[model samples]
Target chain A: MILDSIQRVLSTNELVTAFLFVGTLVWLSYLISARLTRGQVHGSAIAIALGLVLAWYGGLVTGGNRGLADISFFAGVGTLGGAMFRDFAIVATAFGADIKALKQAGFVGAVSIVIGVFVSFLIGGIVAISFGYTDPIAVTTIGAGAATYIVGPVTGTALGAGSDVIALSVAAGLTKSVLVMIGTPFIAPKIGLNNPHSALIYGGLMGTTSGVAGGLAATDPKLVPYGAMTATFYTGVGCLLAPSVLYLGVRALL
Target chain B: MVIYGVALLSFCMLTGVLVGDLLGEVMGVQSNVGGVGIAMLLLLVLSNLDSRKLKLTPITEKGIGFWSAMYIPIVVAMAARQNVFSALSGGWMAIVAGVAAVAASFALIPVLARFGKGEHQ
Candidate 1:
């Protein structure tokens, strides 16, 4: 009787339940990571890792594209994680930044974005070529993902690329960002990631806003704004350059 | 006053979307162009307008702070759900590129550090 009632409840409001399910998993992941890793890893990173694992398992079980969402009760995971909330959160980040501090990064920060984008693009393009994805759109989509996850979809959507390719681009970007998030704290001292300017340059070269933000938050909460500032600019510049100049250049090459 | 602050935040977002729409039309792209970026720029500018004139309070700033940070965890979880599954199903290229990008960036750090040539201490 109790199980039947619970099933009915889940059936009626599955999406909210999915949010609750995700929230619990994320909370649990954070707790484990904090205890096990002594906070060497960000809870967000750990939660993301757990999320991916669960998603893979969900797909393996159901043999469906939507992962856990392939199961009825968990269908809300798809909507909860969809583009609607994604854009809402992206725009929400606007109010959190300080403009004055961004200028502190100066010329080095400015130059870093250009170099970072090119280098990441080149690396991603080369990797795509090796994978036998010879199409210009495929290469460019993945290359833009190397620039930033946000840039990947924006470029892919604009260019009318395949959903699978766009998804691949997003994954590629996510992997880069997660690694940066986990690796930044360990590498900080060795790379001289102390001052606001260095933080800015770090953000520029790294070019993943959330990674830089979470990583800086762990390393030194004071530097979050500085690093995030240039990282924010990196995404904007990446978006601007990728579709036009970068795509045209890739087309020229191929 | 805090409610007014959120209202102002929404206003900034609306204006940003409009501007992004215009830019998209100009650029001949089907998608929105930099709405989030423009909104953030507006917010940065609006933050300076907190004054005795607007009757700004700590509460107003706190409200903005509260909601702004709320997005990060959700965004991370969302990305994990979307990206990982896609990368897995889309073949090994995404994973390979992701690993390669991370590796290449790490390799470039020493070079960037040398070229940057800034003081560690």
Candidate 2:
């Protein structure tokens, strides 16, 4: 009777249950990060990879557009994973920072964000055209994806790009995340990525929050927040530019 | 005290969304642009000010910290929503585009590092 009541409660309060589910997943991911990767790969990156796999599997099982949220038990994940909460988390991360430390990054950090978005978009756009994706929307979406996964989808959705193109953008962003996660430590010493200023600039340039956070964690745990803060800003800047200024530029070029 | 933090966060969030929507309209895009970013800026500015004048209590700080720590798990939830299979099947172009972008970005880090030197003090 107690078990039945517990089950009933969980099913009814789906949002709380979803939180529990995601919490468990994050816990498991951290365990894997600790044991398997020995913390070279950050837990956030692992959690992301695992989430993607689970999403893929959930789709196969349910054949739904909402990914894992299609399952009734996971239904509340739709809201939890939606833009509202995503924004909330992003904002909270900024709240966790010390601004006095941020100002220390100064002009270089600011410049890096603009340069980072532009360079990534330029490279992504060129590659897309080389691949024969001439549609301005496709090129722009893919290029934005290079900026970050969030930027890609946000740009794609804003521009009303096709699903296939959007999917490609997501894939591209994911690849970038994995790369940064694996590559940060290897390159840290050579680039002088030791200080808070460099980390802030690095975050702006790299722009993938999970990637930069994971990479920085492996490099120096103290630097994760600095990198993550700028990375979050990078996402915002990319979203602001990709669909508007960048799209116009790509259209003109094509 | 915790309720105050929640109220402050909510206030920032709502205002951020409004501004983002306006930005989208100005830019000719149909979606909210950078609302989360704006919200973060607001929270940062507000909390910084709070530290100086209002001095939020530890309990409120704890509330904000609780939400802040949710960053990783929330992002995991966000990750779950992405359709990786469709993207993988979309084409090798996706892989190429992504790898190339990151590779180029990685290469430029040292060069970018050069411009910001001497400011670290």
Candidate 3:
């Protein structure tokens, strides 16, 4: 009787159910990572890994378009994870940020973002070209993906690039994200990655908000705000430059 | 008191959305522009206002901190839901681009760190 009522409620309120399911999964993942990894792997990284496994499983089980959408109760995961809530979290986190530290990052911070985007685009473009995908639009869109995942799709859509190319760009960004998350803590000591100014510079250079945020949270929670500040700017700049100057320039060259 | 702080947070969030929407319109993006970034900047400004006009309580800070910490796991879950299957279907090009990009980014971390250390005093 109780199970039937619970299912009824879950069906009636899909978004809430989705949140509950995700929350439970994240909690369990955190426990496993903490216990099994002995804190060597960050819980956020573990949670993300679990999420991917579950998504792949969901796809195989349901043959649905979305990863978790095969199950009627979890279909709302798509909406919950969309830009709206994504933006909401981004905005909300801003409240705790220390703007003074962000300002202190100064000229190096700005320079890092410029160099980061340019270098990432160059690397991505080279890979795309070498992969036998030489179309200028494909190259540019994929290059923007290297800058950041958000830039990948925005640039792809703006340039009217193919779905395959856009999807590839996203994959590139995700790979970058996972790498940054896993690598940040190990490298933190070597990079002298303490303090807010350095955090901002690291954020600008990394250019993956999820990666930077997760990595910083693991290394030092206090640094999340500063890193997120410049990382956020990196995304905006990437979106602006990728679709226009970057595309036109690539088009001219190739 | 906690309720009052929650109310303050909601107000800041709403103001952020409003301003972000306007900024997006001006930029021709027709929406939140950088979405969370814009809202965060707005919140940053609002967060500062506590000293002069708002005088938000410690609980408000606690409230904001709680939400800020929530971003990572949520982002992880969201990103997994969004992108897991793409590479699966997109073929070798996607996989190769992803692997190569990661390798390249890793190689450049030291170069990026050098720039930051140059500014160190």
Best of the candidates, TM-score: 3
Supply every candidate's count of residue pairs whose N, Cα or C atoms clash at under 3 angstroms: 0, 0, 0
lDDT of 3 by residue, A135-173 (tens): 999999999888877789989998899997887898787
Please tell me which model should have the higher lDDT, number 1 or number 2. Answer: 2
| Order of models, best TM-score first | 3, 2, 1
**What TM-score goes with each of the models?**
0.75, 0.79, 0.82
- Could you give the fnat of all candidates in order? 0.39, 0.57, 0.44
Worst 10 residues of 1 chain A by lDDT: A83-92
Best by DockQ: 2
Q: Candidate 2: list runs displaced more than 4 Å.
A: A1-10, A37-41, A133-141, A148-195, A206-254, B50-53, B119-121
What DockQ do you compute for every candidate structure? 0.42, 0.51, 0.47
What is the Cα-based lDDT of residue A137 in candidate 2? Answer: 96
Candidates 2 and 3, the one with greater DockQ: 2
Instruction: Judge candidate 1 at residue B103 and give its lDDT.
Output: 65
Candidate 1 C-alpha lDDT tens digits along A120-159? 8888888988888888998999999987888899889989
Q: Candidate 1 - CAPRI tier? A: acceptable
